[model samples]
Target chain A: MTGVSGGAGAPRLLQVAGLSAGYSGEDVVHDVSLHVDEGEAVTVIGSNGAGKSTLFRAIMSLVTPSSGTVTFDGNDVTTTATHRITRMGLAYVPAERHLFGDMSVAENLLLGSYPRRPDPERLAMVYDVFPRLAERRNQHARTMSGGEQQMLAVGRALMSKPKLLMLDEPTTGLSPLLATEAYRALAELKAGGLTIVVAEQQVPLALELAQRGYVLENGRFTLEGTTDELADDPEVQRAYLGVA
Target chain B: MISALMDGVVLGLQYGLLGVGLTLIYGLAGVINLAHGQVAVMGAIVVSLAMEADVPAVPAILIGLAAAAVFMLLVDATLMRAVYRQEGESRILLGLLIMLGVGFVIDGVLEWRYPIQQLGLRIGGEPIPILGVPMSTGSLLATAVTVVIGLVLVVFFRSTALGRGVRSVIQDEQGAMLVGIDPARVRTFVFGLSGLLAALVAVTRAMTGPVGVSSTISFTILALIVAVVGGLGSVSGAFAAGVLLGVVDRLSSFYIGTYVTTIILLLCAAITIVARPAGLFGRSH
Candidate 1:
């Protein structure tokens, strides 16, 4: 929360080049590359089985890359595993929105400081952004509503003091209002200059929150463009916005 | 006989500690640590070695704890790390097989250094009079140490960031990770902590129990039963189950013959599993 934001000349927060990775037997992501600059919000929109989640997993090092390099904050992290990446100030919050349901919301949030414990100021900053979390911090995360859990997941990531926050389909299970709130929170994060990446299925909403969007089909970059241009594209209209 | 009851209580306390450690490790790592008993033996051997070398008794015990922690940490880092986030009875079996390797390895090494000879290093001080019992200095030290460790573990699970981190992982590893807590590290520490607990049991067991034979393996089996009986990973459950087993072990041995004691305890454990699949003191997942 009270992080010393990186310098302006700092390298791109996340850079994935020629990254190909997937499960042990099957090659899910085929030589796909992506990047998110400092203070940038990028979203990857894809249909089911389109490799959106797989890309996130590969970048996070949960899934081993078949080949290619992933650099974060100017470090060659192509082979680094998930926790190593997290400690490097890159936090990945999954869409399944895994929050330690059995743990109190506050306890779950506190865990974000494990790698860098004894840092209370950062934790206090997370609470500052989400006042509701501070209010219900003592309550178990599982008992909270779907939207609250999503918020908690984001807050927990912030506790890591990540320069970049990557969320996988955070709004998939949320209500319309909750989804909007999620967008608002992410925007607030952008205003505060935290680089972000969101892998989403909601095309228009994803475009609205992010400055640029990437369309993924069958694990390849089917289309990439600015928010305005994609919104106006006929294919985008047909495949995503569902308009004539 | 009063002697029979006392012996049972002493044995039961040791079982309780082993059970707590085993259940905690199992809950967090989902693997059966067959080396729990051997770790205990290693602790006792370390302590005895330290004592024989004129190391202070208190430091000797602490060193044993540290040894257990470090050894278990290695086991998790090297062996158990790959098996994280997978849940199945087979995983448990695999864990047992792995520990089988660890057990033989540790026992083989320990046997070389410390022959299985009973060496009771009595505390230098005189035996303090307690409730009309003719207890020696060593017994008092062992009892006090066990009780203190039990209390510390309780506070740890409920209070410290380390303990809470552990609880969060147990509840949901993936969720815990989203918040930046690495389940892998927690599992390593928990497994090591289990080893430390085994060491504590070893110290007391060495002070008062059979020696020469590979007694660590036998006690691990007992500890596993107590852990399962107490319920997997329940803090209160481990302590409660340990005490109950201790009492049951004593009473049954006194009423029945020593030969039948094992049978009675096994029956009790089986009935408990049938009656409450979770445990007497724990809730099943």
Candidate 2:
């Protein structure tokens, strides 16, 4: 509909206000409000089951929110279906992720743009970012290492030319060195001005990668500020960062 | 013997076409789809009913195929969807029960309306004079349809965006959704296509059956067995298994008897299942 670089001049690509949601008839997310401004890297940090994943699912519309509203690309998409929202230029990466394990890596990435026509330029862009993907393009994604698979997941999302990319955890279960490398790629994307919302258990890595961060505990936002504020705060350090 | 082999080859082609849809359903939705046969049976019923009402054969069969497709969509919405998202054999068994119920209702309706009877729709060649061979034109038509459908499915899955989207949905529903493809809509489209294909194949087989709803159950079960033994998700496997079963069944009928033929084929299928577990070409879930 619009230009390929969808985030250009777009204001507040994703906005979630008072987003309370969960499974059918069972609410887990409570009064969670967050925003991913166009081209701004944001992170939501919390322990497992703190409703971090639920918030992402709610934004993705996998789980319907009973209250509050979600606005994407300046449109009221509170009740929109998951696909329609995604079509609006938001790509979500879940925890278990879908890598088309039996399919070749090229096939997996090729499928990411199924909603739109094939674009050689887009494929080149993804390949350029993740060279490992280009080298193993013919191999099955399942055969790749954890870090490579994560690259595949992110690369696949990028194939859609998304305005906003929401990743649940880009570095979980990765080796320390691999995790650092993953953070570098994520930081590079942030520097390139791709609006992102990443939720992770690895606090120091996430804060280092994200400019603005929210400290979420039990489905509620407790602290919100520049990454430097949270990194230096002893309360956040003891609670999340595990600093001595 | 050559004629029999040729005839068997033609028959096998038909089974391959029918099995493709069955295999796709099992592989993607993880539903056993007991109602799969009812869709085929209904196609024959539609053709017979249309002909009785003065509609031409081709148009009538097309209409029948469309109706079967729609019916499949209905069954998916009402029966298949609930179980597909559930856990284990629970979903499979639930879909089986619902489809079984639908089959019974269709049978009772057909029995009451058409009365049990047999009518044949002949196509292609007349028994070649002096050849002493009875090559069914119907079988030839069946082969042609199967080939076309197979090629079309291949192109669709491999070349088209919509087809890739369907496959993507099957591989990872959640992942596909993130990229703007809804798994539910994909499932509906696939199931509807399956219904249309199964129904078309059923019309080709109508000559030996009472085209009323009563025949739906047996035919659906036959397609299911062929599909399962071939492997649920692989269309090529379904096609191969279906033809393999069809030829063997036809040959056995000549050597033994018609009633004993199905039993022997079933035994072969059971043995295959026991041996491969994932059918012939299917990988694990």
Candidate 3:
């Protein structure tokens, strides 16, 4: 079988086309399309209530798309169950970080490899990425501080050694210092050749970590370019970079 | 008094087993199985019928447990399919009504056809002394089995990957899904396990006294009290509540009238709900 690896003209690792999804017959995310290539980091930058979460949810099959298609690693998976999509190497860490609160940090990480035995090497790698998780391995996820919990969420997702990692607002409740620290870890993961698609209100951090970026405004991609090009755009600068 | 206390302990273990099934189902599915006791009785009756047909006790008990498990799996696949489709309050309400209806149907059938069917296991041996109280061989054996099963459950939940997957679904279903664990599959498995557990309790209880079709309602009531007092969905909590309530049951029956024991137990449940809605060992839902 031909894999999704890219040399030239190969299928992208993930492709979403004409996706419009919402709740109760009301469209929250209008017709939107995006793609991520193998071993590349891409970011979708948008503001609050801009339907970023809705787009991610649709891609994960958590929210049924009213009309659209999602192809992942050469398979059309628009209507697959969330768990099946997850097992297909798409790991998502949402803004709210739907963590198993009653479970210990270690337990949560262990369950990241659900229906499969957790590899010790992956566990150690997560511990290396977030040493705080290593320290509080026995502590319940609910008891950890916001930064620590975020770290745990990311670490837990990494436990699967997923082919693609998508995180929505990973720095939601962290202090500025912790936010940068979280980004630093993401940078490290990207450098290690993990494919990443992160949706963020923290545009500068996301742009710095990603090679290319998409500007999602009002539930549509208003602009898409290399990080350098988008960073130079005055509209992007004024709106997302807090520059006048 | 010592003998009563010993009997209470034995009775409490059985109660804990009974409640564990109901609580596990509720914890994972957000649906209380009101037909839990009826299913347990159905298992007991199956065993009795097999024994009446000259089947050996061991094989008959195994067949009874399998019958109950299969029945629950069928229910999960059929009526529960609709119930699981509903979410939040509607789901809980629908599940309750359907299970209650199932309970009525099973109870009606059992009483209509097997009015005289009862399971009474006779373990011939001298009474064993525990804590200076003479305990019947059946009670001692049942207690041993319950304790062993309890330990196995604890280990399974704590150490096994599939078992932890069950707890993950209970803790946060969305999170479980993201981790590639299907909540629907987990619910179905737990529901079947609950049925097997319910049947197992019936088998153990028969060693002590006759388990008759008429005892269905009482078993259901006892299980409800145990689940409430222990905190629904908490295994350790259920066992803790069982022991405490069992002792209370015996002490009240000894000191007060036997007719009022159920009322007193119900009162304890009421007090628990009023004081701690999450239960003694449960997280607030």
* Candidate 1 residue-wise lDDT, B1-285, digit = tens: 565555556667767888888888888878878888888777777776777789988898788789878888888877875565455877787887888888888878877766665435545677566655556666666677778888898798766888887887877776666555677778878887888888777777656544432776777778888887888877677777777777787787678766876677788789888999889865454
Better of 2 and 3 by TM-score: 3
- Model 2 earns a TM-score of 0.89
Q: What is the TM-score of each candidate against the true structure?
A: 0.85, 0.89, 0.98
Off by over 4 Å in 1: A1-11, A118-125, B1-13, B49-56, B59-91, B104-116, B121-140, B176-188, B206-214, B280-285
Error of 2 at B141 (Å): 3.1
Candidate 3 ranges beyond 4 A from true positions:
A1-11
lDDT of 2 by residue, A3-56 (tens): 222245657777789989988677788888877667777889989889898998
Q: What range of 10 consecutive residues in model 1 chain B has the weakest lDDT sum?
A: B205-214
lDDT of 3 by residue, A13-106 (tens): 8999999999999989999988888878889999998899999999999999999899998899999999998999999999999999999999
Per-candidate total of colliding backbone pairs: 0, 4, 0
* lDDT for position A80 in model 1: 79
| CAPRI quality level assigned to candidate 2 from its DockQ score | medium
Expressed as tens digits, the lDDT of each residue in B1-285 for candidate 3 is: 988788888999889889899888999998889999999989999999999999999999999999999999999999998998999999999999999999999999998999889998888999988899888899988899899999999999999998999988888889999999999889889988988888889889999998878888888888889999999888888999888888889888998868988999899999999998878998775
